[model samples]
Target: MHSWPTTTLPELPDTPARREPVRMFDPSRQAVVALTEPGQQRASMYVCGITPYDATHLGHAATYVGFDVLNRTWRDMGLEVRYASNVTDVDDPLLERANATGVDWRELAAQQTALYARDMTALEVIAPDFYVAATESIPAVVEAVEYLLVHNLAYRVPVSETVPAPLTPGAADIYADIQAIASFGEISHLDAAAMTKLFATRGGDPDRPGKRDALDPLLWRAARAGEPHWPGSGLGDGRPGWHIECAVIARGTLGDAFDLQGGGRDLVFPHHEMSTAHTSALEGRARDLAPAGARHHTHMGLVAYRGEKMSKSLGNLVLVSRLLESGYEPAAIRVALFNHRLHQDWEWFDTDMQAAAQRVAWWRTALSGYGGADPLVFLDEARLALRDNLDTPRALAAMDAWATRTLELARDGDDGVAGAAGLVSRGLTALLGIML
Candidate 1:
């Protein structure tokens, strides 16, 4: 799959490499923990990608940009980062949207995925090292599923009416036996009852008979009529399930046990939880979750509009592409999103864009002027803030203070002041992901 254009990260002034380790909230541990081990200089991340049915909304932008901050933070700290993300190009939602709009599913996925790539480019998000689509990983998916089956970690049940897949005359749908995996619920921290409730609403069949446990997620869906299908296992033509697709893709590209498993808070439950379970199951670990071990998961809060969480089902989307087309600078839109912390869920107002645009204008103007204060101090503050739980609000505050000081104390014939301004501009680009 073709990915978005990569933004060239501007280099900071040559100095000693930064040594701060990033600390983020890990749901499993219920505490803020350092991402890197002692003396570790390499990191990996696997953020779940968009389904691409609806494409780059503000909610979508918030998640990717939030992770982009993490990417920038790790690099600024002199860590080698290997990142992977996926596109659910073949799914029920994608096919349903295509059928409703009278377009082929393949063309729809391609067009929307391309648009998502463009939006990420506009937002200056660093591209993932591996941007896999579910359709592209059938062989790996089949291999992973087979591993579980051979290990007796997964089982087969009758193909049901809920699945779009056609019944394999004698073969049943495959599922990961959650009962067999002792660590299934470790990631979400949700009790069995809570997991069941969420699973039913978020694509689980708790009432389905013959499931080893009510929470067992589908491993592979059998071949269906008028929908995408691939040869998955001996059960006949099928497609991989949501959780399994992520497990294979992340493990395939990033290797086993990576640093982070990140996405929106909505994914905290069955999606992240079950995927982590699948990953652990494949590796023969009976009681572990995620490639990053415990506290390895992070999630951005949902973006809300009109007192409701922004979603395609709600029909109240504020798209990033539309905002850019309406004359808002991409950097300004980024500033608008960054005004809040990663896990802070807040509602959007039109004033958000207005304030961010003004902020961008002021920063641009300040960066081009001269000042006596050393800009590197605030640059350090910016890095510290981001390292501490990806604190975008505090990081932006540091940027604002530097910009104010720069413009307020401009002086003539001072090469020192002129050099300070240039250094501060580069600092913002490298530390805060602001190109100004």
Candidate 2:
């Protein structure tokens, strides 16, 4: 059986310097920041999951594996970590695809979620402690929506019989009002005027009546004919909006303000932005929330294809299952990804995969008769590099140098060579989920 991390929680560190900061990229800050905490060695994290319509792909692997490494590293350092990842089981894509495929929406969701779990296991990404489904969290979602409505952050709008025309300057005032309190531009790294232009082109209209702002996303989207709808909510018969599921799930699982939040860079805009806004707004209303005043740190990894961004809609996509089927080892794929810094995008190429495979082979050969070494020296070096804002690429380069030296020592029959190889393998395994 594959060994898993022991569930016994570690004792909290006594000093701030001893405790690792839960550092992550904050979409709000548009830069990585150390998460503010209520106590030492306690950190909470939430990452949005797939919508269940698309099959798991290289892009999905890159994201989950990246964060899984972070989670493992944090825990290995003796921190108490509670990780939550949500499944967006209900959404417009699911409904439309279900209709086109003539499959039940729930069945589709279940099958896809199961596939995702299997893929994660195959890649050795740790399963999150809380694996929630949006459909199961409907009550929590409704509660959040109700809270927003009460605070005037969200408002219900009647379906317009006639599509609204172009927004005038007066209509722009409504959008501006929501922007003032929402911090919408901050999370997206866009100025207010830039955000307005982008939103307008993406179907948001400032002139729409009953909407507090054109950019104010729907908390509860009224269900249309032939669409999936939840019945329990005080909001009329409709499914939760794409952004609301995350806020509700985070609030329910991680409380008001958790330690770290992360996902693909693509989600930095409307998705993470909305989640941050909603959660912050909710906290402003409740004085007793567990993390009522805590700050959230966010981080995102890069995207790449064959040295380019992988976009299925553009036919440049790569699937994890296909890569495996084509004889790429899971470990090699992961190592190649880790060679790139987690926060920056790098291209995916066969050469990169081959280089990772070469590293694995060299280490395995170098360590053939190796006994364990005191890994702390090498681990400390790697750890220091990682702690400097997760500089994984530089850490990997250090590993490469260490591996090269160890191989040379093995050639000379040095006793420490085997031990050094063992250290390298263990460090890579623990830090990147890459097993030689």
lDDT of every model, 2 decimals: 0.82, 0.66
Clashes per model (N, Cα, C within 3 A): 4, 3
lDDT of 1: 0.82
Candidate 1 C-alpha lDDT tens digits along 52-80: 88868999999999999899888877788
TM-score of predicted model 1? 0.94
Q: After TM-score superposition, what is the CA distance of residue 95 in candidate 2 from its true location, in Å?
A: 2.0
> Model 2: how far is 190 from its true place, Å?
2.2
For model 2, give the 10-residue run with minimal summed lDDT. Answer: 166-175
Kindly list the per-residue Cα lDDT of model 2 for residues 230-290, writing each as its tens digit: 6635565666776767877877888766766678877766667666666666776322222
Off by over 4 Å in 1: 14-17, 160-167, 287-295, 370-372, 411-416
Q: State each model's C-alpha RMSD to the native.
A: 2.3, 5.8
TM-score of each: 0.94, 0.84
